[model samples]
Structure formats: C-alpha cells, structure tokens
Target: MIPTDWIYGLIGGVMIGAAAAMFLLINGRIMGASGLLGGIIDGTGKANMKERLAFIAGLIGVPAIVYFTIGAPATNVSNNMLVLLVAGLAVGVGTRMANGCTSGHGVCGISRFSVRGIAATLIYLLAGGVTMLVLRHGLGVI
Candidate 1:
C-alpha cells in the first residue's frame, strides 16, 4: 500500500510544478521563491512590486491558511535554536551565491535544460549528502 505521506508529497510536487508552469507562462518569469523575496528586500524588484507581493502573499498565505484549516503535519526538527538559525543563514547565503534556490535551479532550470541549474543542483546534492553523512554518522550531531 502507498503511504499517506507519499501521497501527500506527490500532491505537493504536482502543485509546485503547476504553479511554476503557470508563473512562467503568465508572467514570463521564473518562480524562484528566494529570488522573488530577495529582489523585494534588496529593492531590485521595484518595477513589479505588486506582482511580487501578490506572489509572496500567495506563497505564504496558502500554506498558512491550509495549516489553520487542516492542521500542520508533524516533523522532528532540531530543538537547537542556534543550529536552526545557523542553518537558515547558511541556506540564504548559499542560495544567493548559487544565484537561485532549489525551486529555481532544480525545478525551473532543469525543466529548461539549463547547464548551470543542473550543475548547481548536483553540487548542492553532493554537499548535502556529505553534510548528512558527517553529521549523522561521523559526529552524531543529528
């Protein structure tokens, strides 16, 4: 039997792909969440503030609404606030350095057969795998 979590993941993936396709078709823009938010915060997306705000609103609002209505799923996140903060900062910096996040490179870039996206995705995956190996097995930090 298929697990309920797997079903939810498939549904979520389909929604993400559809949203990305629609954003590209409608706005002629790549729907990279980090780029969208970063542009706004950095004053680089002034020309499309309305659109960006609307997109961000939907991005945040939908999940919030869903959680309020249906309750949130459970997860085992680390209790260490320092670790969480450091991880968040690391992801932000890494995404900026990479010129895009997983949504941008992994989904949109790969769909368009972009070499940069493919390479960035491969590098991040390798890095993440190595990090997990070290943290979980070597240091037992996780």
Candidate 2:
C-alpha cells in the first residue's frame, strides 16, 4: 500500500497552489506570507489590515485545526538553542534581503512568470543546496 505521507504531501501541495492562485486572482496581490506578516507587524499593511489579518489567521489557524484533527508527523527540528537562534536569524536576514520567502518566489512568482521571483529562487536554491551539501555530506553531520 502507498504511504499516507506522500498522499498528504501531494494534497497539501495542491491546496497550497490553489490557495495561492485564488488569493492572487481574488485579491490582485501576490500571496507572500513574509510580506503579509511583516507588513502587519510593521504597520505597513494598515491599508489592508483586515485582509492581512484574515490571511495570517488562516496560515496559523488551519494548521492548528489540522493538528487537532490529524496530528503531524515528528519533526527533526534542532534542540540546540544556539543553532536554532542562528538559523532563525539567518532566515530572517535572507528573506529580507531576498524580499520574499521561498513560497512567495517559488510557488506564486514562478507560476506567474515573475522575473525577480525566478532570479531570487535560483539564488536561494543554490545557496541552500550548497549549505546542505556541506553540512549534511561534507561534514557528515547527517
């Protein structure tokens, strides 16, 4: 029998893609989570505070609901406080520098054929691949 995990992932991907497409079509704005959250927190989203709030709510709420209904698999998240802090900081810096997160550039932007998004995606993928290669393989961390 096929593993349920792959099925769940496929379904999740479809849902995310459809949601992103619908959000863009209905709202006429790119659905970038970081931008949405950052704007609301920094007051830049004041113009569409309601919309941002709803989006953010769904982002957090749906997962919580799913967890209650169907618990998630165990994660391999790090327990090291310093590593976690550094990783979080690095992601923040990287996202700010890139102007969007992977979902924004990869899923939404790529689907729309956005040049900036394409370039940003390529750069980040390369960086991430190299980092993973070094950390997981070269250093034999894994």
Candidate that would win on lDDT: 1
Off by over 4 Å in 2: 1-7, 140-142
TM, every model: 0.93, 0.87
Which ten contiguous residues of candidate 1 have the minimum total lDDT? 71-80
Per-residue CA lDDT of model 2 for 14-124, tens digit only, reads 998988889988998788888887788678789999999999999999888988999966778988787788888898777866778978988988887999899999998
| Clashes found in each candidate (C-alpha, N, C closer than 3 A) | 0, 0
Residues 1-142 of candidate 1 have per-residue lDDT tens digits of 9999899999999999999999999899899988888889889899999999999999889989989999887668889998899899999888977889899999999999999999999999999999999999999887
**Model 2: worst 10 consecutive residues (lDDT sum):** 91-100
